[model samples]
Target chain A: MTTRAKQFISADQLLEHWQGHRNLTRRVIEVFPDKELFEFSVQGMRPFSTMVVELISIAGPALKGIVEQQITEFSEEVFQPKTKEEILARWDAETEVINHYFNQISEEKFQETFNLFGQYEFPVYQNILYFIDNEIHHRAQAYTYLRSLGIVPPFFWERF
Target chain B: MTTRAKQFISADQLLEHWQGHRNLTRRVIEVFPDKELFEFSVQGMRPFSTMVVELISIAGPALKGIVEQQITEFSEEVFQPKTKEEILARWDAETEVINHYFNQISEEKFQETFNLFGQYEFPVYQNILYFIDNEIHHRAQAYTYLRSLGIVPPFFWERF
Candidate 1:
């Protein structure tokens, strides 16, 4: 027998929570020196810029797919920016895209399974959590890079 | 006016999600060579063992505080295990402790704000999320360490 799903958080709270993380990550991008943002990585991990691009590619695109009920192929090759300015511009633009699509999801839709990128078959909410989780995963790498550079990264708890 | 808070996920789901990350982290610990587990560092970051201790210090202790409704000072000095087996033993023991206290928390308790460690003041749910979030944060660092050592980390998605 299947158990009824209980809501753990509100959609508004989830959006705000995800956005708080985005804001913190944006601050991370801002703190990086222009050259280092694209070049600095410890332990053979991709540079912070590359990691940021992976995040940029996921949330807005995946949400759009979820809202539209379509499974589209995931790709990070959509943008090839030579500068941090270009990346930040896309980040701000994607924020709006995320907001637009996130509100379209009804609370009930969160429990429906969607095969994200034709691979990860999980509930809508779990997929959304994946997006946020993946960001935190990469941002931690940036934190190490920052500490190595002797630059203090933004506080992890100050998510607003 | 205070708005009604909606539930987005169940406490069981939250515990499962957190444990998934912990399982992946445990794999990382298991793959490490004994000496390197304690000494390896890239970019001046602390060794993975130290980070694991920090995580161990939080989840069980913090959850116990929340369940008991007591605010205690946060400290990582409680455990000073000198071996990987010691750390793993403590990890397994703490898992039970986490499950014990986690079930004691009522749904309404998730909405109440508590001063975590006499430091972080947030709703019970947010505090719990922080515990999970903090684990992923440190575990990501361990992933990098593993990669640098030519040991591939456990698949991040394979939480179970």
Candidate 2:
């Protein structure tokens, strides 16, 4: 049933949308105090810095794998950035890689399915969406952590 | 510089990606206790139910406006659903409307710019992304509310 729906967004727009969310998530990361980003968590969830590492590992590398059609094993070298600035720098580098790899994805490739990171067989578009959805999910956790620390996150509407 | 990037996803994939997020958000809403859904807030933000209403107001109607080329004024008559069941019903109805209007959008229509809800002029694709992004933003707030109340949110990957 879901297969019959028509395409509504172009590949460029999808990139834009993904980038907008990334931008906002970056801002959310910025709002975190240095210690809390690496050390804080509610219940048993990982800290915001840990979550950022997961995102950093997925986004740029996943796009490269998808575009290159190389279904490599998912092995994230855990990045433990002690400072928020270091984390932000890693985030920026990943952002650049995402942009570079994303541009290599032609419109036709979006329809082709690939086993992303040697798992999760879905079309390229869905894979990209997973990258986005995953970021939103973790960032939500970070938002909770921020609020708990009596910090206000950057406004959601400011994506640029 | 960003404008020259090629599109990566078709319209249908975008819709699927969006619906997945919406599905997860619905589950998030369901997880909320009845009174707390409407009453709870962290750092003076509006309750989750209120955020849901704002979403309900925008999505279906925005799609209708975009497809029909009717740039109507944005006037959200606040819906105060008394029960979780009522909220779910409204959500389901809006989901249906979103499907219906989303199908009305043609490939060409997505490229044309429309002043969404009489504000924020962008192409239809960006506007649709806005809807998804806004929902994610609010749902994150809801997640924080849920965790703070000792309720675990639905797993982020289980969007299907």
Which is the leading candidate under DockQ?
Answer: 1
User: lDDT of each model, Cα atoms only?
Assistant: 0.86, 0.81
Show where candidate 1 strays beyond 4 Å: A1-6, B1-6
TM-score of 2: 0.89
TM-score to true structure, per model:
0.94, 0.89
DockQ of each: 0.57, 0.47
Query: How much DockQ does model 2 earn?
Result: 0.47
Q: What would the per-residue lDDT of candidate 1 be over residues A115-155, giving only the tens digit for each residue?
A: 99898899988899889999999998788888878898898
lDDT of 1 at A121: 95
**Candidate 2 lDDT over residue span A7-119, tens digit each:** 56556666777788889998999988888888998775788888888899888888889888898877667676779999889888887898899888877687788998888
Per-residue alpha-carbon lDDT of model 2 for B51-141, expressed as tens digits? 8989998999899898888899776686778888999999988888998999778867877889987887988877887788778868876
lDDT of 1 by residue, B88-118 (tens): 9999999999999998998778878999999
